[model samples]
Every structure is written in structure tokens, then in C-alpha cells.
Target: MEINELTEPERRVWEAFPRGAAVDLTGAPEREIRARVLRSLLLTAPTEDGEIAGLRLLGARVTGELDLQYGLIPCAVTLWDCDFERTPRLYGAEFRQLNLSKSRLPALWAATLRVDGVLRLTDCRIPGPVALAGARIAGALFMDRAVLGTESDGSQEWRDRAGRALQLDHATIGDDLWGPHLTVFGKARLDGATVTGVVQLDSARFHHPSDTALDAETLAVGTDLHAMRMRVEGRLNLRGATIPGQLNLAFARLANPGGVALRASGCTAGEFWMREAAPVEGALNLRRARFDLLHIAPEVWPGEVRTDGLTYTALAPVLPAADRLALPLRDPDGYVPYAYEQLTASYRRIGDDAAARTVQLAKQRRHRTTLPLYGRLWGHLQDVTVGYGFRPMRAAGWLLGLLLLGALVYGLHHPRPLKADEAPAFNALAYSLDLLLPIVDFGQERAYTPAGAYQWLSYLLIAAGWILATTFVAGVNRAVNRP
Candidate 1:
């Protein structure tokens, strides 16, 4: 169509735009679309081509219902110098990338935008606020110096990457945002964006060392918030961003939250500065990263982040509360689970089996209350090394007390002799009673009744107790006594 064939609003927009401002659209075209877009362009860019331009469409507007299925849209070839009074409902609009590098984008509102190519917004301006609450945009949405701020919309002010989301991982955002300097590089930056739409980042990278990445130090907003169950395919950087909402980095991973379940794995921001961040309802993640002094839970750095399987330096302090109780520790020389695991494993390999057993016992007793689940006979002795691990004198004292108590009880209540031996002192019948009495008492009681064969039974019980106690002592020596 000729330039004169354009609608009133279309004509105005083309005039306001630089000399080459063009809108090659198809299907039923509407004038309202042209007028709104033109106004927005003027606000962000007082002049698109370093010259005056106007908006007046003589033709119809390119309007159509959203179609996520085929991603059909009559407004395919979008032009410059346009102001979106409303988001111009394009429900499930899908298309190749829209290059608005030299144009203007004011109040660029949309619920979802799926572009197969790059949604480049190089150097542009926005009049009012740009709301993409539940907008799902495929490909990268590049916004280099393309302001995402709110104009004089009253006292209620807002930010840039608020709303449902805008998947621009690895995309560049070159401004400090309207209010908060957030990196518009995720599926959502709505930490406190007012809109209650659920933001998702199944696996999005957050870095643009090229275009918009260098202008600002702070990048991405989800650094202090959880992607819920979204997949994070890239690094989440929140070097300096105000998080008005709680940060939830748990259960999400840069690799996968399912296979291994990373509490806070994907994020590797050395010093996660969430001082301006809000308290999370559940937990924050810092899993699978090498942090010098992390602030998240100890789980973030379970034990120590070993690099290349080398002896790694402990970054964070072992949570006393976490390590206070002994756990069923795994082997020491094998793979280490956490820092505490090493303690237990050391006991297991403490040179001698007897000593190892003693250490294991100590660990179990010490962490009994604190580590109920990990309280294993063997494991406990390994990690904790309880009660100084059985001193001979201490053992003697306890044994003496037990013997005295037993003697007193025996002298007081001796069972009537089942039979008396005629032989001097050597009661053959009493010898028979010796074994039978234990069977009768223990067998009939249906409980763990101690044997009545005082001399013999006592000797056996003492032997068993000593063995267990000895194992603990050995384990303690191996664990603490070692460097």
C-alpha cells in the first residue's frame, strides 16, 4: 500500500518515527493499535530519528485473539514510535523476535510474549509501567537501556522486572531499573512486583557480559527468591538487588532439583548480599558452591566443597547444633558426606577394632538425644567418641558397684536349693541346678531376664559389656587423639 493508504493513527506514528519508521502488518488492522503505540514511542524517545514525528492511522488496526497453539498473530512486523495505553491483549501471541533497537517502547504491556528469535529492545524508553505479569516469552528479551519504569502513575510506584515473568536469561539489562536495580534476566523478577502471578525459571541463565551486562553490577532478582520448581539452567546473580520478598532458593538447581535434590545448588554468588532481602518462609539455598563465608543454613555447604577431589578448606563453621549429636557416620577413607561424617569414619579406621568399637559407642551415647536417627551402635562410636571412651579406673568403679549390689541381692534372696549334694562341698545336684535355673527364669519370664548362675552368668555379661565399652574407648582415641 502507498504511504497515503495508511490510517490516520498509522500516518501519525510513521511521521513521529524516524524517516524509515514502517509497520508492515497483515489481517484486520485497527487504528487504536497505531495511536497507542505511537504515543508510547514519543514518551520514551522525544524524537526517534533526531526529528519530529506524529501518529494518525488512516487504515485499520491489526487485532487478533491470542493463539498459543500456532502462536498466530496478524501484527507480525511491528514498527517503531508506538505507545501502548493498554497491553493490547495478544493472549498467546507467538512470533519471531521483534527488533526495536532504534524505536521507542512506552507502557509495553503484555501477559505473555513468545518469540522464536531475539526480542531485542536495544535503546528505548518507557512512559508508564511495563506489565508482563504472566507473559511467557521464548528466546532472549534484550533490553539494553530500555527503561522498565513507571511514569507519574500517582504515589504507588513500582519496579522493572516485576509481574509474572520475562524469560531473558543471559539477556542484558543496562539500567538501575525504575526503583530497584534488578537484572531483567529471568522468567520472573516479581519478588515484590505487586502482581501475584506465579513466576517460573525452569532453567534460565542470568548474565550478559556482552551488551547490557557490563553497564550494571547487580543482575537478576530471583537471587533472593525460589523458582518454586522451575529449572535453572544458568547462574543466578544478585550481587546487589533489593529483595522486598522472601528468598527461596531451596529445591531448585542449575542442573536438576529432582535427580539429586539440590537445596540451593545453582546459585554461585560468592557473597550472596541479601542484606536488603526479606526473610524467606522456608529456606534459602547455597548448595554446591564454594563460599568463603556463607550466611545460609549449613546445608548450603553440607561439609566442605571439595574442588577436584582435593583437601578443601572448610568455608563455613560446622554448625555446633548440627554436629552436637553423633550420626551413623559412614567410612572415613571413602567419600565424605559432610564434615561430621569424617569424624565418624576416622573412628572406624582407628588402627584397632577394639578401639574403634569403643569410639563408636561413645558417639552413639553422646548424640543419642540430638541425633536419634543416626544413633547406630557402630556409627555413634565412630563420630562422637562419647564420655572420654571408658577409662580403666572408671570402668573398675562401675564394675565394683555392680558387683557389690549383686552380692548383696544374692546373699539376701538365694533360691532354695533344688537339690543338695551328698559329696563334701561339690554338690552334683546343685551343678545341675546351675544351668537349669537360668533356663527356667529367663525362658518362663518371656523377658530379657539376667541369668541366675551368679558366678558364670555374671562373668559372661561382664565380658560383653567390656567388649562394647572397649570399642568406644578405642574409637575416641582414633578420632580426637589424631591430628
Candidate 2:
């Protein structure tokens, strides 16, 4: 189009494109600029060969849809603080860079879009879905403070389907994907996405109650995935995700009652930090997940947690074994042995043998509940006598108590001698020791036989000695054989 035939706003934009200059029309009367006019200017070259060419327009209302599907724009396109009449269609399109920051758009249909540089959508209010599925960006994708999707439109079909507000499935970003302070009303799906840099979602709010709020299953992040202070009304599913760096969710508030609040099964991360986070209303599913270091506060632990097969190299804050034992105790799956084993292994790895023993003892106590009546009775005997071998001092205490009781009883009465010539002495302590020691015999127990109640006391002493010996031996055997 000729400059002479162009509208005043179009002519000014055309004049500024050749020099890559920004035309700021903030607070000016809204002038309608056709999308085709902007496209034509982007396709045109500058009159001078040495001059740079790019389109930078600010605060203008685009009349028609900026349909650049399958088109290759060589120059950067930046339209800040502008209004789009319709959703911009950039499906299968390639651009040097695209910045639509602070723009008001109904939606963005940019599936399969490729950008050599950053794609900025900061602070934009998009009431509809932003589809970036299969997109490949060489630089960072920034959507800080952007608000995507409106409140439910009262459409049951959409709610049932769990309509996505922002879709980045299979989208690959060379640098970070930053969306701090972002708000989405529906599911924000990033399944199969790969980010070379951090995926920061600090203070973001996602509301998709009774369904998944953020589904990033199979996501591969080269660095950290920081979602500190984030608030989610539904589940945040990160199953099968791989993060080489930390997965920090400090101070996050997640609520999905009767369902999983955070489902990270099979996830692998260098560090997982949830310190000082608010109490989760639902269960936390970390089954089969592995982390180098897990830093979580016990006060924030929910009642129901599924941690079977979960492993972590170490735990933070260096809590005592008794305090940290609550983690495995909170497992909703009814005494998951693997959960206790993993916790024990974690403490062992940190060189806390005492803590490891505490976890193992707790494991035995928990496992007792799942046993039959007979097994449970045996377990109770072992537990009281030797603390399942974890507390060996209990055995010594029981031995001392039994020995003192037997001596006192036998000292009160004298037993009749089997033969007057065979009896050496009537020593109560000696006779008690003889009855208690089954493997070794003292001459006093055989030389004199107790009669009536005194005889019953000898039998009681013999039975008590055998029970204590058996229980101590069994507890020792169990401790030695444990893996």
C-alpha cells in the first residue's frame, strides 16, 4: 500500500518501521489500525539498504485478526499495550521475536509457532485460552503477571472436560519459561514440555477446582522448577517429570479435598523444598519419586500421604529420629514397609545411625499391626522386653527386676533339704541364681527342694527366666537379620 493512501496512524507506523523506532500512542485517542496494514509493513523493506526494519507500535487497537499462519517474518514484531479485536493466529508461523506485552486479547492461537528470540506476554489480560502446543522458542517465554481465562462460563461441558487455559504441551524453550504472578482459571497443561532453563511460577494462582489445575506430566526441566508461594485450588500433577535442579514449592497453598493436592509420582529432582508451606488439604502422592534432598517441615505434613517407593538421599533441618518418624506414620496406605525402609535409609545415608535405628524400630511396631493375633502377641513380647532389639537396655532392666523379685521371695521362706548331708547352705540369692540360670547349675537348687508356696516361687522364677531369654534372643535375631 502507498503511503499517500494510508491512514494517519498507518502512515506514522509505516514511517517508524524503517528505523525500528517505537511509536508510542499512549493516552491518545484510540485509532483503528488494520492487521493487514501492519503485516504489509513488516513484509516491506526500508528504502535505504543500511537501515534496520522492524515494527514497534504501542497503544493501538488492531481492527482485524493478525493472521500470520505459516508466514515467516524476518524482523521483530512488538505491539505493546495494544488491543486485538480477535485472537492473533500465528499457527506454524516463524518470527525473529514477538512481544505483545500489556495487550488485551481474547486469546492467542499460536500452536506450532517458532520464535528465534524471546516471546513476551507480560501483564496481558487474556480472557481465553493461550495455546502454544508444539511451539519452539530459542529464548525465554515470559508471561509475568498475565491473567489467562475467565471465571467459569456456566458451561458444564467445558468444566467436565477440564478446559485448558494455557496449553504448552510439547513446547520446547531454550531459556526459562517465567510466569510469576500469573493467574489462570482453568488447567494449565504443559505435558511433555522441555525447558532448558528454569520454569518459575512464583505466586501464580491456578483455579480448576475438583480437577487438575496444573498438569505437567513428563516435563523435562534442565534447571529449577520454582513455584514458591503459588496457590492452587486443584491438583498439581507433575508425574514423570525430571528436574535436574530444585523443585521448590515453599509457602505454597494447595487444596483439592478428597483428592491429591500434589501428585509427583516417578518425578526426579535434585532437591525438593516445601519448607514453611501451608497445610495441604488433600493427600500428597510421591510414590516412586526420587530426590537428592527433601526439605519439608513436619508441621506442614498432611494427614494422608502416599509415599510408597519414594526415596530421598537426605532430609533437611536435621530433625531427631522420633520427630521425623511421623512421615512414614502418615502414609495412608496402611503401613507401607517401603516408606519406613526409605526413611531409615535416608537417615543412614546422613550418618545418623541412632535415627536410622529409631525409624527401623517404628517400622517393626507399625508392621505388628498387620500381623495375625499370634504374631502380634510375639511382637508385643519382644517389644516390651527389648524394644524389638532397638532398645537393648530394656532387656537388662527386665533381667534386674526379675532377679530382685525372685531373691526377695525365696529369702522370705526356707526350703526343705532333699538330704541333710547333701545340703550346703540356705542362701536365698544363691538359690535364686541357680533357678534363673538354666544353662549353668548351682549346687544349692539341686541340694534343697522348696515345698508348697516356696516350690511355686521356684517354678515362677524358672518360667520368667525362660520367657526373658527367648524374647531377648528373638529380638537380637530380628535386628541382626534386618536389611
Candidate 3:
């Protein structure tokens, strides 16, 4: 089709161009007409070897959208580059098939344009300040190594495209959105830049988190999402970047002392690089982060750990100094915990015998108040103390006399089994058992005087009688006359 066969408005737009080696459309207005011209080019784009068609759009806003998809007869023209050296324009405006990978775009013309089309920039490079700030579109906008913005005074912002929210609603692509090492001196807003594709940034270093995301609900500020530290360079500054989705920060270095290098507060993703990094002053909020516990640092516990690797689990107070007998442990069924059992366990682990004893008494006292078992148990103990404790302790004196009489009779008759110089077994248990049996069953013999035999018998009988009287019953007369 010859150029004149085009629509009148299309022809008027075509006439607006200087038909030279590279047609110049530098001074076109940002009106609907300019949009129409770009749309025409999109529908009937040039191909082939010759540049029929160089369009130097110094300044124009081509806002028309044409659904020019693939198979729309690729116009064979050697459209190598565009020269908007001083113009800010949207040249090859497309709404569908946009493969402008090798187009030489105008540099630093200071324009804010929107390409509401699928921008397939495979190796496309652009120079200057681009403002696609709040532009919303439903296509993939590719800028792989496609530089935006000058490293001048704006060396601290990502204005190469626009202010924020560079929306890419489900822009599916075969290759990664590779822009690893590009520095956006300002914020690069790709808030919901949803891509059903692998977006690879082998070593792309973001300057700061504050200016990097649009709504940036999924960028880690405490940590960088890097592929073995290659997708990043220099110090990363993500102060409050919120990652609402999965953020893989594996092997990324963090530099902030107390401030978190990446703040993935509510992120939902794979393994993160939170280990062996600098301390964080900000929160490493993985509150509801569905991260594998194994991926998290071994030091990272259930509660928040201080940036220094100290977890709350390690700070349990030294099991309270004493038992809480006065306290009650009521379950949903209103049954109190066994006080005695709790104390026993607590004291065993504490390894304090004194405290253990105290806990025991408190438990016993509490048990007596609440449970029925204590009455029988304590009463039994008290009775035993009176019968065995005092009796065994008191009769020790008279029993010694009776024991002496028996020892004398046995010793005199049997003599020493072997001489007093006999050897003893060295086993501690055996030795202890020997000494214990004697102490339990007998007492020491009295010092012998050998007064006459008659006298000896008489004294022995009296001692025996006394021992029996004490063991059978305390003398009524003696007790009544005592006080």
C-alpha cells in the first residue's frame, strides 16, 4: 500500500513527518492526532533493510491505542532507531504486539509519556528522564538493560520511568525482567508488577527501599533478594519496604547496624537470608510469614529475637525461687493442678534441697486444705513420729544396759571370732551393712568392773527390769508424780 492510500487523518499524520532517511516527527503535539500517527505506525510498522522511516519526535504525546497484534503484515523497513535527541515522545505506539527491542530511543528529552501497550524491549536502551509514573496498562513493559534517567542530580531517584506504581498486571514473558545493577537514584515503583514468569535480577542493586516500590508491599528492606550476592552491588537501603508476598533473600548481605536492611513484615515466600548479617534495630517481622522454620536461622525462635541472635526462649526466669503453693492451676474443667506434683518437678530441676523441702511442706499444707488424702497421710506420719521416733530415741539409754548384758555373755562365751587384728572386707556397701546391723540391733557394752558374780547378776537383773518396764509402759506413778 502506497503512503497516500492511508486514511486522511493518517495521511495528515504521515505528512507531519519529514520524509528523509529517518523521518523527523520531533515537534508533534501530545494530542489525539499524534496518538493516531503512532497508532498507524503500530498497525502498519515498517520492516526490511531501509530506514524509510526515521521519525525524530522531539516532543509529542501519542496517546492512541491500536490493537496491532502479530501477523498484521510486518512492514518490511529497516527501522533501526529513533532520534528524539531533544524531543520527549511516544513513537511506535502499540496496544498489542510491540517488539521494539533494538529501537534507538531519544535521550533525556524530559518527557512524561505512557505506552499503554505491550512494550517488548528485549535489548532496547533508552537515555534520559522518563516519567511513566502513574501509567496503568495491561501488557508486558520490558526494559532489560534498558537504562532510564541520567546519573546527574537525580542520582538518588528512579525517575527514569515515572514517580511510582509502574503497573504490570500479569505481564507474562518468557525471559526474566533483568535489571539487576541499574541504579534508580529515585524510587522505582513496580508495586504490583505481577509477572507469571521468572523475573531474574542476577545482580541488580536497588539504592533504597523507600524510592524503589510503588506500594512496594513485597520488597525486603532488611535483606536483599539476591542470587548468591550477584544480583546486588553496594549498600542497599530498604528502611520500611513491605513484602506482601514471597521474597527470596538468599545469600544477600545486609549493612544496617540496627536498622533492618529489609523489612519483610508480612511477606509470604521461600527461604530468606536473615542469618549471619548485621544487627537490626527495626523489626524483622515475619509475623505471618509462611516460611519454613528450617529456612529461618537456627537461632530464630518463635518469638522475636533481638538482632544479636538472642531469643525469648533463652530468657525464662530461674524457675521461681519458691513454689506457688498459694496459687491455683485451674483447667477448663475447674480441676486444680496437683500442688505436690508441681513442686516436686520444679524442685528436682532446680537442684535446691532447701527449697525442695520448703516446697514439699507448702505442698503438703495446701494438699491438706484441698484434698482428702492429706488427713490420713499426715496423721499417720505424726503417729509414727511419736511411737517410733520418740521411743527409739528415748529407750536408747536402758536398752544400752540390756545390750551390754547380752554382749558380755556372748563375748565371754564366744570370744573374738578371729583376733581383733582380723582383716575387714573393703566393699563400702558390705562394710556399711555390717555397721548398720550392729547399730540397729545392739548397743555398746558397759565398762566391766568384775565386782563379784553375785553383784554383777543383781545389777544386770535390775537393768533388764528397767528396760522391760520402759518398753512395755511408762510407769504410772513416775509420770503422775513428775509435775
Which has the greatest lDDT?
2
Q: Rank the models by TM-score, top first.
A: 2, 3, 1
Q: Put down candidate 1 lDDT per residue, 97-182, tens digits, no spaces.
A: 45544343434544455555545554545444444444444444445445433322223223233222243223222222222222
* Candidate of highest TM-score: 2
Give lDDT for model 1.
Answer: 0.36
**Which prediction has more favorable TM-score, 1 or 2?**
2
Candidate numbers sorted by lDDT from highest down: 2, 3, 1
Provide TM-scores for the models: 0.35, 0.90, 0.39
User: Cα lDDT of model 3 overall?
Assistant: 0.37
Over the stretch 171-205, how does candidate 2's per-residue lDDT look in tens digits? 99999999999998899999999999999999999
Query: In the order shown, what is each candidate's alpha-carbon RMSD?
Result: 15.2, 3.0, 19.4
Residue 29's lDDT within candidate 3 is 40
Q: At residue 242, what lDDT does model 3 achieve? A: 36
Ranked by TM-score, the better of candidates 1 and 3 is 3
